[model samples]
Target chain A: MSSAEKPLIGHLVIVGVGLIGGSVSLALKKAGVVGHVTGVGRNRDNLELAQRIGIVDAWTHDVGEAVRDADVVLLAVPMSAYASVFAAMAKTLPEHAVVTDAGSTKQSTIIAANKFLPGPERFIAAHPIAGTEKSGAGAAFAELYEKRLCVITPVGDSSATALALVMQLWEKTGSRVVTMDAAEHDDFLASVSHLPHLAAFALVNAVRRQKSEGHDPFCFAAGGFRDFTRIASSSPEMWRDIALSNRDALLGQLDAFQQELNGMREALLADDADRLLKEFSAAREAREAWLAKHGDGL
Target chain B: MSSAEKPLIGHLVIVGVGLIGGSVSLALKKAGVVGHVTGVGRNRDNLELAQRIGIVDAWTHDVGEAVRDADVVLLAVPMSAYASVFAAMAKTLPEHAVVTDAGSTKQSTIIAANKFLPGPERFIAAHPIAGTEKSGAGAAFAELYEKRLCVITPVGDSSATALALVMQLWEKTGSRVVTMDAAEHDDFLASVSHLPHLAAFALVNAVRRQKSEGHDPFCFAAGGFRDFTRIASSSPEMWRDIALSNRDALLGQLDAFQQELNGMREALLADDADRLLKEFSAAREAREAWLAKHGDGL
Candidate 1:
């Protein structure tokens, strides 16, 4: 890679070397976005694994020590752990270090982050719309971010230089960056990502419970069930944190969705085939309209 | 290929060379499961396309003529159209012809099958859970069933030999077969397939309606939004048929799903982070548990 195109990152620090965090480090190193990466995690085993994999240049358990003198810090832990990590090092971040994150809930994370960091402007929140249902260092991949959307949630008066650097880093890692407010990001995400997770979980649970009543439970889980509930195979701890952190927005979204479903249910109960068909047609029309915008079939 | 492992089919008749229909023809032919494949479609042009693509050895607009001498008749058309096709060809089918279908809802399809064919034993309901958002003969592929699940919904005293032949054809094309009750198949599929389609359409409409309110909604359409709603991109005509045909099961499923969402919303409204976390965790836990049993994940 030419020097100009080379990832100009040097002395990078990554907090929580799990799937998202670990994958980001590998991709950064492979893309030469960062010259060196320091892995930080509360779990010594994870840090050791991250280092042994040749992804992390160095590692430490001390939050401030790991981040001190680093040009960039990437928090890749669960939303629940955000406050503690930030509180541990927020008072000591260097003047020029751009602090970013790979957490799911942007608004709450930023709120937790604001409580610890002295300079809020130095922080940039990112949600990479990439990840498998898998987690941990072993799940890391250099191509994880390729063609994925990385939403940047900007808080008050974020420095342009810092924002641009974060954008450039993600772009180098093969992600398209989209900017939005933290609240909007949370609400939109709840409807799209969080709600789906909830739906998948509930559907699976309902069936599993029914199976416990002595029916062959998993017997009916065909490919459609597998695909529809794929994300349900996610990290429970991480999802729990996300659900808690983005509680209000997710709940609002859930209510809206459930109400629509109830309406459809009523239509079905009355044998209102025409009304049901109308609803289905409306949804089909909307979906087709959206897909047309996504460079797919007309 | 080993003789025992070689494709068992010598002649295949694909009735209704539409998307899934055409795809099945292409896949079986490419896998060497069918030595000579005949194509049948209401649209003469589609049959021509299937023949041009090398998936069809012969082309015919008449369903009865196409399956007259064929070893297998694969009904690859809409569930709504199955009755009409069966009505046209039931009397002309070869005594040895194993008739199978690629319908979404199985119970209704089977019930309808009984009306046309005195020989209900020859009919087998199969759902290959592999497809793209696109449709038609132009989108046919040879490996559509590779590593996919093909659900077989069989009725009373279905011919063992005929079922075996249908099963062998799918297995030769790299599909895993799961035998299920036709009614249960409809219920399971509604939650896993139909609901997701509805959700996708709702999400698209939510955003589209926002755009109509002068919001440049497309700007907010990030990767998460697109992937989460990708099912909405499926063929409107196909989905419309599914939603209507599987109305009862789909409606029941919609009610259950709505209740789950409503519970979450109530928790959120109450600022019951604890309850929100509990429900979300339940969803996550339930999904993960189901996946561990069904998914490659541990």
Candidate 2:
């Protein structure tokens, strides 16, 4: 058995126990990595639910109270809410406490975190790949992190101890942890996350508009359409902030994809069935290989 | 109780017992919707499996042999394989038997089917909403169509008895079905299915090209990236046919989406965060509403 399989002992604090946060809270606590997880959220009902569920041994609305002497502090709130959250808790943070996040975008969070937190070195920005279509503390589950990736982004001025503690926490939750520079992480995520979001959003708009135009004649829609466009239903405020924050990188990614789409259009226009088939086959092979290799906690 | 909840009578003949066909076989047998289901397939192994699993009361390689005294004939092979299969069975088909399909593109299917089959009047084209990322007879399951929409396209001519029988079969299999024109169904499905496949393929190619250009980025791709690009792994030949068959419709859908994307780009270029957020919020709200009505099938 690995170290994670053994009983863990650490006091962890999680702020904003929504789907990702509450899930992490449950996963860490159940695995016994956390001695007593404490949840902090703006909603009193959420705090009560988190406590009743025992995702956290305790719950509170005060940031300072939540962070005091916490061995590890996790910010699971939206990116826009992080700066103020950090600002509220920085003063009372235990000097040795490791601060991290479960945010989607990292660079902006790191920059904002550095300005608000008492010690820039104490904060490490991390993005856990585990998520569901649901949200809130009620949506949180204990096994959310199993077999997923948790990317840790270390700022230039961040401390090694903070990074290691954050890594250790994710590992204990059964995650495969990796690290990258914050900017590089953001750039890559823009293509992977932001661009897909935009594509889904655009597709949804297209369908909605076409429906209005009364053009949908065949009605071949089924479960596939629903899944493909599901992300278009995500919190628009959160995604919009992400798009704006990662605008340049996402635009670059979309331009590159557009060129590919244009080529496909040309191929179709020319009735190049063979070429289109070949391209599709290549992508199919590439994608299946990747999915097979990454089967961790499916 | 609904008729679906009651036991089914009569023998149901399922042609081309591949994934959808096999599943229909299994579901009909399991739900007691039919006393017996006879399967026709080119693959000997599939026939064997069908017998072993009790999905079929009997099986045959010859299409004419299987359709002897049948109540319904369901074509479940790839779209491209339809012509040969239709020609093989059309002449020998039971005169009153209802003919339908589990095909993706409908308009062309109808046109080709009309020409090949003597009794186009007996044909109804259906597209089921239920499926997994998996395929083949081994992947068949009875519950696949439960609560899933089975979209039917009634083309130029129709036989009321045949249409009613086909609709009855779908209802017995637990499908909430809708009917639309073959041309319109093609248009809707292109936007919903074909275009998403193209987007996924293009997205994967964009990254592949970028990786070829310089950075070792694929190494850093996590679950979000994998899931977002999941559809890129679909059957290439299948997707290629879809693109080719629905080229005009896909192009129009793509154009509509591109215009919206360009609008978002203009907003970003002008640094109009307000407009971007507003658009994002609207999309999210609309999606959530749809999801609320449809359930979290995503």
Predicted model with the maximum lDDT:
2
What's candidate 1's DockQ score? 0.25
Model 1 C-alpha lDDT per residue in residues A124-151, reported as the tens digit of each score: 9998878775778878888888877788
Clashing pairs in 2: A147-A297, A217-B184, A217-B185, A218-B184, A218-B185, A218-B186, A219-B185, B8-B32, B8-B33
At residue A274, candidate 1 shows an lDDT of 70
Backbone clashes, each candidate? 0, 9
- Clash pairs for candidate 1: none
How high is each candidate's TM-score?
0.72, 0.75
Residue A71, candidate 2: Cα error in Å is 9.0
Give residue A161's error in model 1 in angstroms: 7.2
The A-chain TM-scores of all the candidates are 0.90, 0.88
lDDT by residue for model 2 (B100-127), tens: 8888788778877898888899889888
- Model 2 lDDT at residue A164: 76
